[model samples]
Target chain A: MEGRLARIGLRIWVGGVLLFLFVPIAIICFYAFNSSNIQSWPIQGLSVKWFSVAWHDPQVRAAFVLSLKAGVFATAIALLLGSAAAFGVHRFRFFGREAVSLLLVLPLALPGIITGIALNSAFSFAGIGLSLLTIVIGHATFCIVVVYNNVIARLRRVSGSVYEASADLGAHGFFTFRTVTLPMLSTALISGALLAFALSFDEVIVTTFTAGAQNTLPLWIFGAIRLGQQLPEVNVVVVAVLLLTVIPVIIAVRLTGGGGITRGSAAARSAMDSGSPGA
Target chain B: MTSTVAQGGRPGGEPASSRHAGGVPGGGSARLAAALWRRAWLRATLTLTPPLAWFLVIYLASLVVMLVTAFWSVNPFTNTLVHTWTLSNFRQLFTSTYLIIIGRTVGMAALVTVTDAVLAFPFAYYMARLASNRGRQLLFTAVLLPLWASYIARVYAWIVILQKGGTLSWSFQKLGLGAVNIGYTNTAMWLVFSYIWLPFMIVPVYAALERIPDSLLEASGDLGAHNWRTLRSVLLPLALPGVVAGSIFTFSLTLGDFITPLLVGGANSNFIGNVIYSNLGTAGNLPFAAALAVVPIVIMVFYLLGARLLGAFESL
Candidate 1:
């Protein structure tokens, strides 16, 4: 039928579109190991020396440590503030709570350049030199939204009755939260943490404003890409970051099974079920 | 992080033992337990504290500074800023050269938005409504994959392609078209900007389109409405928030972004981002740069508000 023919054509078009999205990237990643220094054809022999050289590059090494430290601290901050903020806003229906929740998420909607300028100006005025601390602070602002979204959604899913039951059972405020609520929200927290880490590590716009003297991986890579560094070494660094990011992404994906599934069992059930690592 | 997650400290079960151990310190075990409890709460607060303070101190305070600086006059000879306020920064921004820059930024952003939207509709529709789940996942990942790659590296990738006899040129040649000479032209800059930002548009559009209820489309089709009209009236309206969200994200990001233009547009063209970058770098005019930044933020806030208003209309 004509319908079937149309469907087949659609599939090919979709596949082509997807290919366009990823092929150049795949080619670049593949050529990372290609022996040629210039980005060109006639694929030559392969070697791991480029990666080692990239690893040994001092700027890359220092940026790697700085980004790692920033990512960890930022993600940790996002997780705690995000969870507490979520619990507070979600559990208690207070005046302006919805507005506050919206305020928490609005930073994400604003462009990174806007937030960058805001942070940069404030830091400069306060005699606050751009250092590791400033970089972490800049990253944590927008990164809050990631964990906040995850925790808020998870908290919303946990019915008020669940908490009410714990209170009715003569459990203290701390005990009820620790024993009952904590287990349920753990997966959302973990998934959010992974995502926040990835965002913090790769963030450059805000980093540009906040990093007065230090270079994160992206900042170093940004200078090298335009100014011309060892292209192979840059490619090698790109590959390493991709693996580091993608693995956590896959785990986050696995941890985040369904976006919404409060049909039967509690959300806690889904967290426990992902104990078997699919990837 | 995975390795750091401690295991087998206390199981979810064992309520009786948990109660006995709680708040009843007897000996070393009690001391150890108290330390663990104290550390948990302390760690939680410590993790959240510094960043929370930073947002209040830096982000909240900076807006106040921006407002103050907008009012204050700059002393060029003295090399200091005075609190004696004036509106010259705002006044000067309205002149022809600066207005031209704002006009160019908005014009390019509009062109990019329309073209990207047209391309993204078919692409996102396929991914959301037509592709197999496995295929969809692959497609979605492909859309997000570019974001992880260094932004500068991707801009550099275009430098290779946009030149004559490059991959794009080769494709044009094969199509019996003359070699495309887009270098240093607005066309090349637009194309490069489009390529860099298309993924941003597709993801949100896909997210929005996937949320369209299948029954609404099916019902429209059954009632003798065709695919295009069904899409126009049913699917499109439902996906308005996503489109708005995506558009707001793309336009605002592209408007503020100077990287692509700096790399590809050459010295002739500059975006607000480059203006800000230059101010902090070679220009050594931080106040003016800071003042210029307020222009786009104010424009974008209005732009987003307009989109949100349109979103409200779509809901009706």
Candidate 2:
């Protein structure tokens, strides 16, 4: 019953929204090549001079390396802990199971500042110093939920009969687990690890409190932005980060067989559904 | 078939019932596996302990410690936490300065939530119902990509566009509107907050709308209802849980954010997060910061309860 004019109007509106969403990102990328230090509209000359500056900057290199280390460590921890928790909740019915699910989600559901300050207080109380270990702990706390959600959703979809058949075939539990369960969970784990790494890589809020004097990539960018002097360097670093982030996400989408990020699982839906509380 | 069956039985070398009774004749690791396989509690405990211990000890304990610290006051002279329980930190939150900060934060969060819901609905509708299969996939990726992009970079992009002598001013000047600088203003913060969180609103709404079958819309059209009537009666109600689910993100993200205010806010734009952050860091007032942090936590607990009541969890 819709009219032609209305349909066309809707299409135009959608196109406009897309533009609104993307133009700022385009502006950031475009400004990175600006030859002049000043960031006014319209181009002066375009140059790649900032690339060398950002490359040579000791602070930026340290931050990038630190971010990489934290992301790798955090993703490793989340994969182990998250899958364990997922199998716990999925394979067996136990008391407090719902509470466990809710608890697993709490780090993600609550605002990041809450998580940040809470961990900060606890660290100081326990006489623990803020370091790379602390940053990984903060990131892994949230990353666990992402991995948990993916694994549990996949676990739910896998048929219980397959395990039973393996058992009946005189294949012991460990052997069946190594062959059957691991293969079934391979994609889910890969996608989960990729996403977890991405999240830990770009994370800023919880990292801010937990990093102490250390700078992750986002923290370095924040300092630079606040200083307002290193516009070009910030732009270069940001472009690199965009690439760093987009690759994993693209890989994750492909690995999940192209349901896109939000459609991966019900738990993922709830996780994203909860939104990034700190962002 | 007979040979294959005999070969399989030969490996076991005993009746299955006898194997069950004696726990499968095997080496230590295999025996341990057999024992674990039989015991449900052991399996649950083995799988559950590490993650649960991590959460309970690290995550949950930290929250409890923060909450307890909120009651204890910090000694100003020594810059040490006084273990004596007191409500003075919480009492300070009721002061006029703190109250305004709380009001502004909640108000802005509400405004952003409304703005995002309005902006997202039409776009999500187009994606869900109108786009072709390939088009829908592209739109989904477009929405998902920015989420993974650095949050700081996105906010920084806005700074470049909003600052004096920036892209926005250049555009305005070119249009004969004279130079316009809205940079470092609350207005800038509002725009950035709404912009960043818009995808959070769209994805869930699109998911909810996609779940609605096409036959229902056709049925509504056949019942003598017009386009607006079908949208209002058939579509809006069905899509509302999604909207509420999205609002939870938009609202809580705004409520807890300090970065936007720090980057783009003017002199008067001290959000609760900003205040708490400063207190915990520069001010060295941990107790006060913990007390202030409680406000958003309480707000979200209620907000989440409201969302749960609206069936937003189901949509998610």
Candidate 3:
């Protein structure tokens, strides 16, 4: 009886913690449809006016499209770079392989503020016009590291001899890759692509530096807040952005979740044993 | 190797081992040997160029440039940078106001790191050791799932909680207590930072706790050593790396994040990131801002190296 009571107490504590984590999100979702123009409580009449306003806003739409464009291009570029790097790292015994790997992953560790300032300074010094091109290029840099890690880890799982065997059977590089490598890596590739897309899409800190003059979705929101132009519309757009970012995020994470646990975890262990999990 | 393979191959492609017996030959070789080495190198370059260029130009070179500009002088009146190298940009960085902001940022990061670490340990432990397999997976996913959510949306979500009519106060009022005015407070900043960066803490701790072999815990119990001692002596040491990783994520992120403070930190609660943003944006002092930004990176380079050294020691 005492043990049962103790278990209930622990469970209650768990519930309270989860509630703390989730309640704010739930509140934001609730307030998006809020009839009141201001973000206030005590139930103003329910209206979807803000949502409509958000939907019709041209600036919001443009920012949305720009973010989408940025996300797609960034992910594609990162994938191309990351995939090749992964292949190179997996196969070649280069002298500075570990150094290269660290350099690739270092951006993730360096504060986004640092990356932003660096890119900002670099762009200005070079007199390069900051546009969607600069934004896409900026996003693709660190985003590459994430995709590279995912793909390389997955590649490690696929036997090296498998690729060798295909070559031995007189198969050309492209054909062998299409048949043998692509099939096994397809899942990982999809997950990595989705992850890259999400990272670029929701990214704010680095984007602020790279995005000069033009605003992506996140920057647009920040601008809206700074300008204090439209409150309810801002709330509605935030809700929309939430949905946009969350859906892909959930999908990417869930898809990779199982893989991260079983085969992925065992690899982490063995890598730890070797004292280098590539950080 | 290519010549050996070609010389070793038979017409029928049978007994491929014969390719090993074939030695390197002159330029005259089989039909399929169409400049393999050259092609491989070309393919490598072509495949590798885009990412390499992007990294070099955007990420790596940009940092080098920022470092250079941090030491340069800029004329605010003309909006032009002076060619003269100077330390005034850096000298002005340690002013009383900026130092307070830096201190606040580090203090908030520490608070968030500590709170999140404590909260994550039990949850991760239960999931790793106590929960059923499916249950554990679900909890772990729930933990990592937040990292995917929109950053702005997440920030806005917290405004609802910390604002005047937020649930914390509403509940307090419900319980016949006075409402808590958390808005624009440091508490609000810490709470939001902890929520946003909680996944960073969870993922690593979960990974480390999961790595704690089940048998080890059982073996401790078998020896009649209580759970506390076992956890202290075994689990803590083993999981320290993940804890360090989590700390880095929370600390570095909190220190660099102007976003959280902008959304919730109010006017009085400006951090170093916010200071840098202001100096660059509204203040229009790029050189001073660049100097402020460089400070954190210099701090982190040392911090990351220290973490690695400590990680090396912990592993040993």
- Which candidate number has the best TM-score? 2
Q: How far is each candidate from the true structure, as Cα RMSD in Å?
A: 7.7, 6.6, 5.9
**Weakest ten-residue segment in model 3 chain A by summed lDDT:** A260-269
Q: DockQ for each candidate?
A: 0.20, 0.46, 0.41
Chain B TM-score (each prediction, in order): 0.80, 0.90, 0.84
RMSD of model 2 against the true structure: 6.6
List, residue by residue over A166-188, the lDDT tens digit for candidate 1.
85776544566689888988888
lDDT for each candidate structure:
0.66, 0.82, 0.71
lDDT of 1: 0.66
Q: By DockQ, who's the top model here?
A: 2
| Candidate 2 residue lDDT tens string, A216-265 | 99999988888887878998998888778778878876676433244222
CA deviation > 4 Å runs, candidate 3: A1-10, A257-279, B1-50, B312-316
Model 3 interface CAPRI class: acceptable
Off by over 4 Å in 2: A258-279, B1-25
* Tens digit per residue, CA lDDT, model 1, B1-316: 1122232233333354456555553644543444444344333333333434445565667767766666665577775666677778778889998898888888888888877777777787877777776777666556555644445556656665665545667677788997677866778888877776776676556666776677878789889887778878888887776666667656877788866766688657977777777766323566677788888878887986797687722321
For candidate 2, the docking band is: acceptable
